[model samples]
Target: MSLPVPIDLHVRSYGRVRESDRHAYAQLVLPLDGAVALEIEGRERMLDPLQAAFIAPGATHSQYAEGLNRSFIVDVAPATLDPVVGDRLHERRFAPVGPEARKLVEFMRLLVERGAATPALVAGWAPLLLDTLALDAARPLSRLDALLARVEADPGAPWTAESMARCAGLSPSRLHALFREEHDTTPRAWLLQLRLARVCAWLGAAELPIAELALRAGFSDQSALTRAMRRSLGTTPAEFRRRRRT
Candidate 1:
């Protein structure tokens, strides 16, 4: 096969609910609009126009996007990239796309839009884009710094909006208002996202039983877990494990 031949390239949108998957080919997600919360190998980060995410072959990953989101994606075969570069890229999660690289990305996006992104053009641009990518940058401080830290540190805790409001030293109404202002979501929704994130992070441990994992994530039972997983991720725990287990 030609080195420049990518497995796939296209623009895609993600939903508000969290979903998980893993694939044999590496992928790069460059946002065309809006931001996405992406998790790979248990690490979570936000991906926006200024930032992009890289997923290594076979890595278990999950995503949730706020509002509307569309991104340019390139799925690359493992053998298509240089061994050294691919190895380095496997560890890359979210990284800053420099000004020049952004320009190149825009140019290529226009080409793809115009139906001009041929195989050779993609092959050439793909590696060059990867080469230009740097390591993940320092994260920006979150608006809900203290509250988010506590919740993230203990996502499985029996957390309620009232409890969270107490922890944050805000009234329930004020807390809800603040979440809506900053995150465009309510307290319950954010906590659910946190619990779901915990589920994804722990799902990779093959020895840990799914039922136990569900309880740990604060779900009532395996049935509840399955329902939540299906509602948020469109897949059951068993299917996620079967497809994503390394």
Candidate 2:
């Protein structure tokens, strides 16, 4: 079962993790080659190829490595995960990669090794790996498919839950309930996911200035976009763009 979400999966590392800071997006550090020293909250540990770290959104964390190290990094949206699984993961800092989860990690590593981690391939694998980490399946399909399509088509629009509810011809509270029932998320969170997905895809698939891309993705400013991306994907826009280009 693959409980997928709007996530950005990249195979890379942040060398010499010093001062600790935190973001609002949950992240997983699954080692693929070497060891990474990771500290979540106040707990410290060394992560090897078979080990992984689950960093809950807004939890203080940092990392460092003495030599060559790269891990399969997953930047996940917490709202998209099963609430129980997400809470359980947040309570724990480290876990041995289970057989099924390791298989997904290995598959990603192999694809990267073969230079086959194209947008389409990565897109398909991203949600699976995210879901596997939480051991959950996908969210239920939304009944408002038409409204969803319109949102996808113009993600940069000034969209609020109220506006979306009006578009769908429902009261705002009713729309919120429907989103929760059908999508397992709120209207605002869903819209954020749509915008973030667009930004990630565009960062990997095209060339544009960060500021320009920010507005085009419905972010109010460059800093706002950066904060949102860092909070949700566990990576800055520059690093994400660099990874795609190189």
Taking all chains together, each candidate's TM-score versus the true structure is 0.52, 0.48
Against the unseen true structure, what C-alpha lDDT does each candidate score?
Answer: 0.75, 0.73
| Model 2 steric clash pairs | 3-137, 25-231
Per-prediction backbone clash count: 0, 2
Clashes of 1: 0
Candidate number with greatest TM-score: 1
Determine which window of 10 residues in candidate 1 has minimal summed lDDT: 134-143
Predicted candidate 2 versus true structure: per-residue lDDT over 1-246, tens digit per residue: 122545667877667756566777778888766688999989998987545788888889888888787788877776655567667566666765544565566566555654567767766776666556555222222446546645755679899999999898899999999888767899999889778776876777666788888899899998998999889999998998899778
RMSD of model 2 against the true structure: 18.0
TM-score (C-alpha) between model 1 and the true structure: 0.52
- Kindly report which residue stretches of model 2 are placed more than 4 angstroms away from their true locations once superposed: 1-5, 17-19, 118-127, 134-246
